[model samples]
Target chain A: MKNNVKKLSDYIDRLNWEKAPGAAECGELENLYAAVRRVKSLKPPVMPGADFPDKVVQSLARGIKRAKSRKRLLKSAAAAAAVLAVALLVYFAALKDTNIVSAMERAYGRVSAYHGTLEVVFTSGAGERQVQSVLDVWADKQGRYAIGVLEGAYQGLMTVSDGEKVWQSPPGEGALMPVFSETHEFIFELGGEIEALKAAQSARVAGEETVAGRPAYVLEVTPQGGLPYKLWVDKETKIPLQKEGAMHNAIQYTTRYIEITFAESIPDELIQVEGKNFREADIGEEESPAPAGESPDEAFEPQVRVEVDMQAEQAQQIAADSGSSPWRLDPVFTAQVFVSLQISPEGITGEYPVDYEDFTIARTDGRRMKVQVSSDKTEIKAVYLERLVRQDETGIWTVVGYDISR
Target chain B: MNEEGLKFAAEVCRQTWEPLYRYVYHKVQNREEAEDITQETYIRSLAYPKFREIGRAEYLAFFKAVAANLVKDRWRRNKKRGIQVGFDAAANLAFTEDPAEAVGERMLVEQALKTLSAEQRKVVELRIIRGYSVSETARMMGLKAGHVRVLQYRALKNLAVILSKEETSHEE
Candidate 1:
């Protein structure tokens, strides 16, 4: 009976209700036309609006905290191996009888927004290292995630992304570094577990087990190209809550969710690391009170003082060889005020004075700068660090970086 | 309610907010009304003398039952607002409003739905009424897509049989 319903469901899904179902279009089950029609007429789920979850919490005001601790709260108190014993209490509570194959699909499908603590134990690939984040990840639909390190060696680091850009706070520094190249290799494994099962030579339910206080189907499968895996899928929600992978006949790693909450449309603010205007940061430039009017442009522009007696020969020598060069440090304009500009023929006010980089040079260089800010490099290896500044959406100076002559 | 009881009630409110709102919204099919009913359900929970005594596990059921009764009251009011009865009057009912026959047909269908086993009923709700795709339903239930389809076919077939039986009984 269960399998019969499953097949009928698959057929209806394939139908997508594009046309009315009848004996002509659908055989044997033509009597339920009204039911199918009503389903088709029904509206899609209207996601709760205006920050629903946050508003509900705010509505509760003074009566949370201590009372909240009473309802299935996973005590995140155990140091290091806390989550080894973590129940993942209510996250996996809904799914009670799910198995391996269905669990993988559930985790892969239908999940657009989620927050969870992922405990990763390296069994072989790196030695014995266990990392369990008390507060781990909250990913929006865009896969822009905020990976938090709350109770580990990386106690205060947070990495957030806005699809096109990533923001990371250096451990203990609490400063937002604009972008970094961090591939969530573990997350790839989480989503990839499904594809692995699909590409597997054979997969079978090894047994039934309880993982994190939820009944789960234990699956043993060997993929076509990758490592063999043992997966625990929650019976109710079917979300793959825990994974144990093997290499060379030994357990290599296990990634388990200590707890998780799936919500409708996590706020954009979750992934926003604010006010990181890289151009405004004083790099190596020494900015002091301008002594006097040392420039011709000082009248219109605020008291321009060029106290820099930079080696002029070095700038000339650096620009000579690099054809249509983008990397130019006019010591005069940059020494006191390293203000970024669009540098057009009409030359915007606070630009690098004179033919710093002609359009031919600027265009060539601008494209490169645009690419770097968008690149996932953890650190920029540049003698001139001002290239890190990405312009605001409306600004003409969206890219401002150049490769040094060195 | 004492301070501790109020605190527990507040905690339950926080924990079950999303699911509670979804249930009300599903029943009312109106965002504004669902929100109002959801708020009202919580308000009643906080005000009820025995709210402090309700077990943590019973919070969801208690709230849902309250929402269900509220929905029934709403249906009664709409009936009072002149949903025309009798074949002659119902024949002329507007396209937007359900006719008297349609309401009877729905009641029959609802009775047929109740005859299904829990698993069968869930399949009908997720696949038929809720209109989740088989794949999506399969994912939610942690069942094979094939299994979901099979469940829906039997559930509907059973509904058709039960609905047919209801019609015969009404005629008799």
Candidate 2:
């Protein structure tokens, strides 16, 4: 029967040669099972010699060594070129115009306070949507600052710091969450964004252009692994009149800055969030409720539950015993782990020091554990280790998922 | 390269060289080219800065992906050069390289394989040629295990019919 043939075929394909029915038992399907086995056992015309593996290993070793030496040679050549360029710059200091990157850096450094309307247009599904927000930023040389978002989804978001603690109003919520100044200062300043632009792979002045009916210098910048952007700086004041760029490689979506202003000083009332209409909220104690019908005992077991502060060594030991990498214990290094887990870190080089409180370990049924690492504010980086069952031979626990922001 | 990197590269080469060489040899139908491509795959992988960072379990899959990309690039280059590249010609070339009886058997198998759909051929390649478990094949192909089993069963049944017809025609 057709059903018998299908069943016998499945059995043979499963490689249950013993359990698979014999020719007499399979009847008309006998040839099918034999054919399947023959197909499975068919070898390539040419088999690699026994020494192929060693040859491959030696070839790779040599290639890697050559690549390293070539990299060193290029580094030395680049250093020599840099010294010559510096000397040439000094000799032609009076004849040549100032570099656009330095000019832009100087212009932004002189700005103590600025306000602007940021208009961002991005594609969603079939159509486009625009988000317009009024941003007010104030900064001093001591790294003290305040930033206010007056429109868009982050209408109530306000952050103020007095060189110590940062009081931030949560987006869409009228509650002030205080965090360490060192942790949140970068979030409320434009200096960090400017510094990133200054470190772009290439920057050049693309002649003068008229922006908002005023003559401005058009500076084009291309960042590493990012799309290019153009900034129009006012010729008279050297302040940016407008900046625009495609968001990443999305040619259909664009982000632009409009209605910019530079101020001598911001109002004292605008720079402090203490008397603002916001209730204080402590985010450190907040935890999402566990899913219903899920028992903690069934999900995982706490290897070491410490309510008090513990040393880095204890955390490392807990990670090691749980079959997780000890590198997940350090907050700064854990960010790198997250990066490697999600994507390939081929040529990326930088330090990502996440401002966090501590880490907690919980052993799961599988050869993995749950790590709860909290940041300075409401954000908690919950890293869950996934025991790669198929790759258990390697004994590497991959980061299955993490909640870095939420 | 660091010691850990070298150890990892050696382990990967040990596990993957055979399957990778077979895959390339079948496509190119030339031993020398297949060996060159296999060696190049390892060299390119080791030269990558991220190769050492890749998890041990992922090394095989990464090597396969790299090998597949190299094969595709070679095919494109050959096409640009106006080379006569076809499955039948490659299969015939492989068959001619073997003994007389093996030539007949391999030609019959290659002919039967050509009868299957592209998706079915891929399943055969991953499950049979590569000797991957059903679940591993399913994961690689992004299909459910049940679906993969059904595909394999159908593909094998079709191969059986094709081979039977070839034998009958030969007898005639």
Candidate 3:
């Protein structure tokens, strides 16, 4: 364990951005590379619960709260000045580089719906071999879309959003999994780049090219203090046809619409898996939430409630001679964690390791107390001890939560 | 910044919150930390000189860079993407909007995962993706802990080989 900590610290200190080295440069540290990559967001994406956004909002408020009141006072006083600043910004932004950008933005924005295939090709150093991935994409004005993997290891994987819900089917045979609204990550706001380009200090029409059988104008744009990128826009329609550039580290790739067709309307079937059954998202379904707020659909509250005997000794109040937790109330708890909270009626057995990051509460009967899991059981994430041992809320401690990260 | 500028900045932060949080979440692999970093990314970006003048792409790039810096800070964090374009190969792609790159990277990795053997793939999923302890993974896989370690090393080696062959990522 000490060596692991030392290894991690050494690995971290070795990561020098001044050198801007890739994980490939970790040398013989393959284990570190793999671990680092996983931590870099490669986990199978989980759908966030319904109240996830609200939780983030609360967190965000907390994060920026220090300066908020001060800013609020100044902002209220500068309201008129801000209006002029916005107008001047608009005027200057409009004047700097208007035609191709504004035109291309208009072109991409005007269409209500379209079908297109994007193929991104990567070339090796020797240029002897090339690998390509193709996506079959369909989207409508109503924000419904379907993305099918046409070529790649995940060739059959499909993600569809039917305006109301997002469903994803893994690479092989499996039922579709619902992506809860809170955790649904991607919003393909098709032409969001155009707006991003509007702030670029430089955007110019460099030349012309033929893309997807249409003549197009190639525009070279450079954002402030940024590298330049080329975008091909159809001459007649102004829609973007291709984007080619080095994203970071100068690794190069070219993405183009190999096949595209404008349409008056896109059908709903194209945006939904009509016959497939979607597995229910487990969050807020049967799983116990944090003990206190205990909402059916939200992890919005930071603390859930747990009941302990207010009059009993602290150790005896938490468990019997061996020790355990309040999650003994549910059967699902057993499925997620190996430790069973119930052993006879004494509460938790010799197995439940409880040192307590959350300690006993000093609050009077019926008030919220702080409760949490010890490090030994980080895997059992969301278990609220339903209605505690003695009901009526007396001696109930709120689950303040823990890192739960191993 | 002026009140209207602050409002506009808030809107930009709001519009890109999902992708921003997702990006940070991937880096830290912890929900609370990701939330803090995501909000910090926006706050830091909003603090940039003349926040009103930057475009959404630039704004996104700035926030992603801040996110990257925050991750590195946890690992080591300052420095925005476009602001400090290194002369090295990695520096060239820093300003391209990051969420697209992120999505593309995920697709590439997922594609590569399909190439590994089932056992190797499962090892990677449980040990790495799921962050299960070695004992837990062994228990779930019905293998001894020693064997689970071997499987993990082999699976990573296989992934490195596959990813290198079809590499398009430009890391910074």
Estimate the TM-score of every prediction: 0.31, 0.31, 0.32
Clash-forming residue pairs, model 2: none
The list of candidate 2 runs beyond 4 A from truth reads A1-95, A123-129, A132-134, A170-190, A207-214, A224-227, A241-256, A277-406, B1-172
Q: Model 3 over residues A156-201: C-alpha lDDT tens digits?
A: 4566766666666545454222221112322223565576568777
- In the range A1-406, model 2's lDDT, one tens digit per residue, is 5575456434443432111122324434556555655565475446667887888888878877777776664678777688789989885683256665566678787987665444433332233343323344556645666665543333346666666655666554433222211223322234554675678788767889866334687878777644566766667666665555543212123333434555766667765666665433233432223347867443433332323223543444443333234222222233334543344334222322332224444333324446566645324456655334322212334454555563
- Compute the DockQ of candidate 3: 0.06
What local lDDT score does residue B48 receive in model 2, on the 0 to 100 scale? 70
lDDT of 1 by residue, B50-156 (tens): 55566666677677776666655554552344322222221222223236865676566677778999998998788656656554466578675567776777777
Off by over 4 Å in 1: A1-108, A124-135, A174-185, A188-190, A247-251, A276-406, B1-172
Error (Å) of candidate 2 at residue A67 is: 68
Per-model B-chain TM-score: 0.45, 0.44, 0.63
Kindly report which residue stretches of model 3 are placed more than 4 angstroms away from their true locations once superposed. Answer: A1-31, A34-406, B1-9, B77-94, B97-118, B129-133, B161-172
lDDT of 1 by residue, A241-319 (tens): 7877554212244667655557776666655567642122211231222227633222113212223323543342333
Q: Quick one: ranking by TM-score, best first?
A: 3, 1, 2
Evaluation by TM-score, superior candidate among 1 and 2: 1
What TM-score did chain B of candidate 3 earn? Answer: 0.63
**Residue-pair clashes, model 3:** 14
